[model samples]
Target chain A: MSRLFRLYEKKRGGRRTGSKTVGSFGEALFFGIFFVVGCGTMAYMLVALAWPEWRANRQFEETTCVLVGKRVGSKETAEGEPVQFRPEFALKYEAAGRAREADGVYDVTNLYSSDEAGVKSVIEQFEVGKKYPCWYDPLDPQRVVLVRGYSLWLYVSLLIPLSFIVIGGGRMIYELAHWNASEERRSVLDSAAAVDWFEAEAGERHFPNVPDGSNQTNSPGTKLAYRLPISATFGWTLFAAMAACILWNALVAGFVVMVVRDIALGEPDWVMALTLLPFAAGGVWLIVYFSRQILVATGVGPTRLEISDHPLVPGMPYEVFLSQAGRLNMRSLEVWLACDERATYHQGTDTRTEIRRVYEYRCFVREDFEIPQGLPFESRCQVQVPEGAMHSFLAIYNEVSWKLIVRGHVKGRPKFEREFQIVVHPALAGQLVS
Target chain B: MMDPRLSLMLDEPQRTFRPGELLAGQFFLEGVRPEEIRAVEVSVLWHTEGKGDEDMAVHFFERIDPDLDDVVDLRQPRRLSTVLPNSPLSYHGQIVKIRWCVRVRAFFWHGKELAAEVPFQLGAVPRPQEAPV
Candidate 1:
């Protein structure tokens, strides 16, 4: 069982020290339990509810039976519960060259009603000593029913347990496939190998570790070879904020409606009402916050950055064009060439990522910058990659990246920073410095 | 009889090489019967290590099935080689490190498997220290 699904595997580096940690086995177990229970209950419900309907309609023998007597029968369902009534009849039929007498129920569902009048109305459809068509179990002539069909309520109720099965089974399979498997194992399964079958080809002068820069280099620039793509645009941020605000308020509105309905019934739920106050306040704050973001995004207009070359190398100089369009007064505007190191780690079950700026060089700085409504601010800055700067590195859990940032402080408005990502290739051997 | 053992050896004693340099290695099995071998897999790869999940990329890979090849011998040493790429030099950082290794795994017909690895350095990049904030 451990081989099939590992609850704990030997930690990679910790193997030498003989340490262990909880593995995907724990996750698989959790989902596996849900899968088993859901399937069991669903199977039981299907066999109990659907099997009889199917048998009555498709497999049971249809025959004519004389209703000797019909009456509205009542039975106590449970303690303190009202009595339930159903239409029943004494059935007489001939099957397999033999006469049989049986008590006939109205339907396979055995549905009962609290009102005796409803049951009497159903029995009125048939008269005593009249022949009526009914279905009898072929294997047992004594088992019979007056009606045969599916119950919509029972079938619809299956969806609840079905959802659990889908979620649990799907996640269980995924966890089993990825549990403790290394990246190479995954790549192998994906058939990502490109080298020669026997060995790596000679003189293959490619930097496989360097990230591709085609995303930034695809668009042609008016004055340069490539236009660097912004990491995050103000418009996208504003849209995300607006979406969050709408979704949050929509959820809060549902709870408020529930509370208001309870109050209208004169049985107000004070605990629920008190719990909704903080959520209602949060929705109001989100609305206000999103409104301010909208104003700033509209006032900021757009920012564009273009670079002369891509896949930059250390000890190289490049030209960058910066443009800002808006009607705004700025205290200062600065462009910085920066490199950041990022690492992601797991703490218990929580995953977190931390980033730190490892290198930064001032490219251009201007004071008392202003932009008129019709006139846009445009400038070019000469940026140099630091000689000893580490090239951009990317792995599953760590990364080193370079970027160009534009910081603008608008008078009487919040300062905004726009970032443009760039890739840096490994420096030449001679350029390396200690 | 001694337990089955797998040994891996790098051509370079120091196991250090520059980017775009050739990396060669070999592996041998001992205390294992030849008929018990099912297949062998060899790879030169780099993987990340530290506080986070490890990521790996294979530079070269090959598999040999002794049952399919009439001339293949599981008892003899097998050679493997590859040319390293010019980026992602072996790094020893505060939170993350990249390590290069030549790994050989052998599958036995009895449902047992053995693995051996020899670590090597890809570049001479100095260990990095966090810059003062």
Candidate 2:
């Protein structure tokens, strides 16, 4: 029985303590969201491309015109002069009462004449015989033009915004999957250990804290573990938003296509709901997203540090003190000093120290040695602190400032940097000048 | 040695024409180099100041010679006169002298090489009158 139990323990040990099933589910969910959003965006673009043709075929008619006359001279002067003249073929159409009413009455009268003399003058100036392309509805043969073509650029321009939605949605889904998988594994391990007699024999079995399991090294809960759900929520919200946007775009395209088809079929007066509704909604969403991001960035509290008031001369031992001032604690903090090229360090005195202040989430301690005669009065010194650490140093040295560098991942969010300057007083200058 | 360039002096008709009226002018070209010139083509080009350091306008070529000789190398000043726009110019009965300059180019070797160009302003012409109703 002892040997059999040993074999069983070995076999159980080989099995991963975490739940593989949960991890897989999380990964599948992530990939599913990514695929749906990406494909939807591509479909929206393709629908937009076909929209113009759908509109054109539904309303306008094809017609023909003969070159009457050329628009001569500069664009400015060509207006008063007959820009184009109706050819003889157009005369036949005019005789047959086929001339369409010119669209803008005022511009037509001011720019082109309607009288026979004007027509004759235009025809005389015409290259005599040239065929021009025009479009008109068969029902109303009067509408015609010297130029006709569909502008394809309108539909092509939709790709830019669609691409952004796809990229942002894909990245969010990836992060969500990673968080979900890790959470599942953690729960599985906790359950497996709880079932083991040896682990449960003690009042509380203490397992090595998994990386990103919980904030407290001693406790089972950690900030990293809690952040997984938060990340998932954010990812799902973004995915839903992207899906809605794609649907809104597709609906708008369909509506435009329907309206165009109606107009082409000669239902010119058919009124459809203004398609601008979706565009307006999209604009509002963009504004909200931007404002939310800005608010989050500003609400992350400032970094604070403490510094001792003393002259830091080259080749001298100066005790530069540091501490945090804000409620938030930082993961890492650092300081760097630079002096003139001719400066030299004192033997065994040039050293850098980093101290993770115990129990001080908002505070840390560090000590650095000043190279003897290493820095001159005119030289520059720089102090750098990572994001989330509060600095009291910016207040002490009037000339020196705290510059925040990289803010590490906390809630799957990026780090930010800020700089503050401290001033050195005239009284303290003499100590360092010597 | 004289440079192979042409200089011109233009004089406009004493009156201006209406909006659709055509204006006429006389332009004379004098050769700086004593070289033979085959044929001379006159054109009325519009002129305007461009944004940068240049001028912008169009040149409307109007042939004055109905029968331009194949070649006539000239060492002395020559004179020819004809209508402003004929079949070759093809800009007849149209306004060509709005803010205009008369440019004359001497063609040589069956129109292979242009010997010289002479440009001169035609002071504003009288606007054409409306025919009595």
The clash numbers for all candidates, in the given order, read 0, 51
Model 1 lDDT per residue over A102-139, tens place: 87467776667798887888899989899989888888
Over B18-46, each residue of candidate 1 has an lDDT whose tens digit, in order, gives 88888987788899988889878888888
Say which docking band candidate 2 falls in: incorrect
Whose DockQ is greatest here? 1
> How far off is residue A264 in model 2, in Å?
67
User: Against the true two-chain complex, what DockQ does each candidate achieve?
Assistant: 0.37, 0.00
**Highest lDDT model number:** 1
List model 2 lDDT by residue over B1-133, tens digit each.
Answer: 5445554433334432222234444433344332344455655443322111112122245443324653333444444332222101111111111233455665443333342333332322222121110
TM-score (chain B only), all candidates: 0.91, 0.37
Q: Estimate, for each residue in A58-145, the C-alpha lDDT of model 2 and write its tens digit.
A: 5545444554434321122345763442323231123134454333111101123345465566445545356444554454555334
Best by TM-score: 1
- Show pairs that collide, candidate 1: none
lDDT of 2 at A174: 49
lDDT of each: 0.79, 0.35
